[model samples]
Target chain A: MNLIFWSSESDDDRRDTQVGSWLGELDPGRDDATYWMRFHRDVVDGSRFELARRRQAAELTVVGVVSSWSRTLVPVALAAAAAAGIMLAQPRLDQVEPPILVEDVLTMGLGDPMPALFVDDEEGGLLLASEIY
Target chain B: MTSHQKIEDPRFGDGELVRRAREGEEEAYALLVGRYMRPAYLVALSVTRRHEDAEDAAQEAFLVALQRLEECRDPERFGGWLMTIVRNRSRNLLRRESLRETSVLPETAKSGEPLPDRVTERSELDETLQAALAELTPVQREVVLLHDLEGWKHREIAERLDLPSGTVRSHLHFARKALRGKLEGVLTDHVKG
Candidate 1:
């Protein structure tokens, strides 16, 4: 019953099965061996594997050396140069400007500092010394 | 240990080899190269048909495999992963050659020994098979080579190719059918000759 049920296979299945049988009957010793052996001994040997290997090794080495050199040396060298440059230019930066202060603003309002007073308005705010008529 | 025991692969039954390779064991990679280099080269040659191109593709494949070993989802499935790299590299090499040779040879001339051996009937069979294989589209050729020549199972082939098993089945079916037809045609000619 099971065989009967499985028997109605498609044309593709039948064809594939036949091919599979042919594939099974193929002697690996005679044809495949000769072709593979010849291909390996002759063609593969003549290829550019050696050149590629050397190139790969050189590329890796250069990358590694450059990476390490950059990691350790570049930062230290840059930092030292920057520090030296700043040391050389310190006085120039210092003489550029003095910061603003509260005393500077107060002196501007008082006009030679006669005496100072203050008052407050109901709506807005505080009035400064000269306006305290 | 007995010779039988000693003949057992040092890297077998342990994922340690993969771990070591990941940790930069060039020797472990060398061991892998020693193992797969021949088969990989053969596959490359079969696909590209050029001696120089095959060797370059095989070496590039091995290098790529080593570099991308971390992407190997299953450490034990390393061989299949390596084969995928070989296939991809060989295809890339062939594509480049095709582009370069387009102006020179409009039809990409396969690079095997052009003369068929006349001595043995078996050699004729090989020649026929080789020619038939060459006639296949690259996808069909790849599927046939992976499944028939390399002895990979459908599931394995599907996974390696990142295709569904059903698609792999369809490809294999068509490839084998095409090959059988080609072989039958050649056989008829050879018999006449």
Candidate 2:
């Protein structure tokens, strides 16, 4: 007989059934509406939830602003770094002599028949590749 | 399930409610809490066993859920996400209860004095119900409560609990059978038409 009507006889399915109203009464919603109602209020209106919400909102605001700033500042900072990189990539001015010296060019360009560089050697004299050989 | 068991607000779905709550709408939050309150309580009850602990766990879970609402990722599945929090909080409470068991005796621990509202005749039945529930596995208790108490379909229980439909039915069958066995005399006496 139960095989045909298990669904209907199932204890306190709570659909117009007195089979297990006691179990249904155990439900907090039914048993203690006052307490659960207070619980709902506490969750929505209690200072604890409000404080937590405000705290989260503040933290999110701070994070949101910082992230927005990063979105803008990050590329600009990167480009500035890139510009510095280009300048650094170039040879240092302090390590190298000038491309041309008026004195060396004047005297050596006149004296040197062999087409050569008129760069002054470490001794402050014009040096030629042919002379070194 | 009763009409009150599900979403109290038919106008707004869980997603819209979550979005509104995230935008700091207290009404939306109240709706959300009202919607999930029973389910959350039942889930916590499935784990914590004690009603007061279950209530505490459920309330704490709601607060934690609100605090971490943004991390929910899928607003549409707010119920599932809240259930997860409820489960975790229940487990945490159980662990705390286990730890506290050694050091402190609970005031409500069935003293000679009758518990409030617990008329002697009814309290014995309540104790029998609790004892029967204790005999069930957590999953069994959950399945039975969700199915019989909430009037959920087996398939709904399966999807919500991630169990096969057959398994849900099996659990429901066994859980009810066990409760019937445990409360045979009391159930016969209390059965009204």
Candidate 3:
């Protein structure tokens, strides 16, 4: 997995804040919590250095883990989700919305909310949107 | 071979380096990377107009160049070939990430003021040049930077940019004119100071 970090002014911090908040929702007791903490620390340290060098006012940084998704896993994930949905009255599978077309996603306005259907743990690690369906 | 040996050989030119690199010589490839990294970064920066993006694009271009080293017909012009890859990669990145969000002008331009008199003449000139370069269209900047800064001929720039030689000449002419117009005041001020 590759770790990506982005830093910007606080006024332009919307994207980082949103991604940070989403990551915060994950259970801290999970096995991957350590990885997230390390990623966060790296981001904070990197942002501090960058901000100090640039002398920018009110810097913010966001970090995320990105892993490649295998093509074969798509069908497997779909089958598992469908099976789990049929077994449970409240279908978590329904939460896995159809993958948005790349063109449609590209056309979306900057302010539009991105669909967050796929979870990162196919190989038990974070998968980027580009990596996932 | 040791780094000392690589540096010592007068006959070991770019073609020799390319041949060695093709034969799995890591030292030869490193030498090539060292030689071209700056120019490659400049080419990418001309397109992307951002330092970080330019660095990333240049690094990726080197890797791609290494992988496709066999495809190079003339090792003598490896710099131009690698630059072509860098240009394409930078343009592809610009397309993928909408340029509207990423194409920011330099900080000097955003600050919107000439530097104080205490600033060195060279520093002022650099800042003015940066700002003027930022003002140019991407294609114009690319042509001007390659031709003027890199000392590439119009034919070389045209081949890499995939434009006609006449168009490259035209772009270079207009870009220089625009730069001169933008910098005239700064130059005059510097001289008077």
TM-score of each: 0.47, 0.64, 0.44
Give the candidate order by descending TM-score.
2, 1, 3
Q: Write the per-residue lDDT of candidate 1 for residues B78-181, one digit (tens) a residue.
A: 76677778878998987886686665553224553333322344456556666776776666666665566546676666665666666666777777777878
Span of ten consecutive residues with least summed lDDT in model 1 chain A? A1-10
Which one wins by TM-score: 1 or 2?
A: 2
- Compared with the true structure, what per-residue lDDT tens digits does model 3 show for residues B119-182? 4434554566667778777787777666665456666666666677667666666666777777
lDDT for each residue of candidate 1 in A19-62, tens digit (9 for 90 to 100): 43333323232234454344333332433354345445555666
Q: Pick the candidate with the highest TM-score.
A: 2
List candidate 2 stretches off by more than 4 Å.
Answer: A1-20, A29-33, A47-133, B1-7, B103-122, B191-193
What residue pairs are clashing in model 3? Answer: none
Per-residue error (Å), model 1, residue A74: 21
Candidate 3 or 1, higher DockQ: 1
Indicate which candidate wins on DockQ.
2
Q: Write the per-residue lDDT of candidate 3 for residues A1-133, one digit (tens) a residue.
A: 1222222222121122221222122212123434323433333333333324322321222211112234566778999999888789665666887889998888779786767755678578877677766
lDDT at residue A24 of model 3 (Cα atoms): 21
- For this target, which candidate reaches the highest lDDT against the unseen true structure? 2
- For B1-193, candidate 2 gives per-residue lDDT tens digits of 2424343787898899888777667778888898888778888998987778888998889888887878988898888788889989999998987787656654665465544533345466667788888998988888777767766666566666767766766677787788878877775565442
Candidate 1: where is the Cα deviation over 4 Å?
A1-133, B1-15, B42-46, B50-52, B71-74, B102-127, B185-193
